[model samples]
Target: MQIILCESAEQVGRRAADIIEARVRQGPAVLGLATGGSPASTYAELIRRHREEGLRFGDVTAFTLDEYAGLPADHPQSYHSTIRREFVDHVDLDLAKLHTPRGDAEDLVAEAARYDLAIVGAGGIDVQLLGIGANGHIGFNEPTSSLRSRTRVKTLAVATRTANARFFEGDDEEVPKLCLTQGLGTIGESRQAVLVALGSAKAAAVQAMVEGPVSAFCPGSVLQLHPRATIVLDPGAASQLTMLEYYRDAQALNDGLQ
Candidate 1:
């Protein structure tokens, strides 16, 4: 795992966008995308690149990692709608290449399987973008979920529901009880992975993910097992990490004269 401590959230977002743009230029890049407040800045950065840098996504295909089951696709709080507003509408990506697990599908399992097949058929993801939930969940794969599991429906943890409540008229009860998410095994299949975290609220989770044992208690910790995973954090989020200063120096040296 590689740790990158950026000066601020915007820098982290720009760096993540740069890596994604680089991958998309190589070929038909398949991207594993995530939603939530943690990734909002990164999405903004990508939009900026698309508008100002001519970063095209015509050959790029994307699969969102998860979506709230039972939620209307057009719902403002739905992941599908968020993606459309933040990404799909901003870029020139082929609409046919975008895949979001159907929230209202009659057979969710089949939809999940279709998403997995699409990823496999595309030669796996070129880059997987992730956001670590406050409870350490990744892609709605809550704590205690099997690392080897595949895309499927999962019950939302109480913590997740509460965390998501802000988006749903401030009513925790309005948050969906279940979601469909790609599993850790699927995430590990990516050629590269980028996990972004910001703010002091994420400090504990960031520390657990970067330094703790790879246990199901903290799903984000599984990223440590990936061959190429980058964790980008703001200083507030890296506060609890003991080796953050070392990582900061290393990144400065690696990006020398930039």
Candidate 2:
């Protein structure tokens, strides 16, 4: 695991986009994308590069991490629309190649299975982007979620729904109680995991995920076991990490070598 402490949220976004652009430049690549405010900046920067720097995503294949179980693909709040509005619509990425879990499928169980197969069939994700939930969940794999779990439908924890209420006109009750998400095991299979967090609100979860014990209670901690995982955070989010100075020193050394 590599921890990169940045001075601000925008820097964190730039750093993350740097990692992603490098992979896309390596040739055709499969990318696992996440939605929400945490990744909005990164997506924005990528869009800027595409428009101002000639960055191309024409050969990239993308997959969304999860979706609200009952939301239609056309719903404004659906991840399908969210991702497209936030990132896909701005880039040259082909809509046909962007795979998102069919949250509205009549048979979600089968849909989850098919989503997993689609990922594997695409040669696996070259780099998976992630966001650490304030409650330590990742892709809706809430507390106590099995470390070896696969893609599946999961009941939304109250806290998770509450946190997401902002997207639903500030009504927690309006948020879906169920969602289909990629499990920790499925996420860990990606070649590279890039998790980005910002603000003091995420400090504790960030600390636990990077420095605490590897337990299912904190799903994001599974990244600790990943062979290649990069954690990008702003100073506020890294505030609770005990080895803050060490991470900064290490990042400085890495920058020098590069």
Candidate 3:
């Protein structure tokens, strides 16, 4: 695990984007994408690069981390629609290569299984992007979510609903109660994982995810098991990390080595 503390949210995005650009350039890349407030800036940076620096995605295969259950694919708040509107639509990629769990499928259980199979068939994710929830959840894998669980349906926590209420015009009741999320085990399969967080609001979750004991209580803590997990954060987000100075020094040392 590498902790990269940046000066601001935008800097955090740029840093993560640097990794994404490097990975994409390595060869055909399978990307694990996530949504929510945490990754919004990273997506913005990617879009900026696409428009200004000719960053292309023709060889990329993208898979989203989760989708709200009961939401139509075209629904404005749907992950699929959000992905397209905020990231995919701005990039030059083959639409058919992008995949998302079918939130409104007739047989969602089967679809979830199929989604897992599809990811494996595609050789797993080269690099997965993640965002820690305010309550320490990753994707929609709420507290106590099985560490070895696979792709499946999950009930959203009340905190999650409240956090997501802004998307529904500040109505937590309007937020979907169910979701399909790539489980911790599924996320661990990725060759590399990059998690980004910003602002003081995320400090506690960031601390738990980076330094807390590996436990189901803080689902994001599962990232500690990943062979290659990068925790990118702004100073505000890294504030709660006990070894902030050490993390900064180490980052500087690593930067100097390059």
Clashing pairs in 1: none
Which tens-of-lDDT digit does each residue in 203-248 have in candidate 3?
Answer: 9988988889999999999999999999999888888999988998
The CA lDDT of each predicted structure is: 0.88, 0.94, 0.93
Per-residue alpha-carbon lDDT of model 2 for 28-101, expressed as tens digits? 99999999989988999999999999999999999999999999999999999999999999999999999999
TM-score of each: 0.96, 0.99, 0.98
For model 3, the stretches where C-alpha displacement exceeds 4 angstroms are none
Candidate number of the best TM-score? 2
Rate residue 42 of model 3 by lDDT.
Answer: 93
* Pick by TM-score: 1 or 3, better one: 3
Residue runs of model 1 more than 4 Å from their true location after superposition: none
Model 3 clashing residue pairs (backbone): none
Q: For all candidates, what are the clash counts?
A: 0, 0, 0
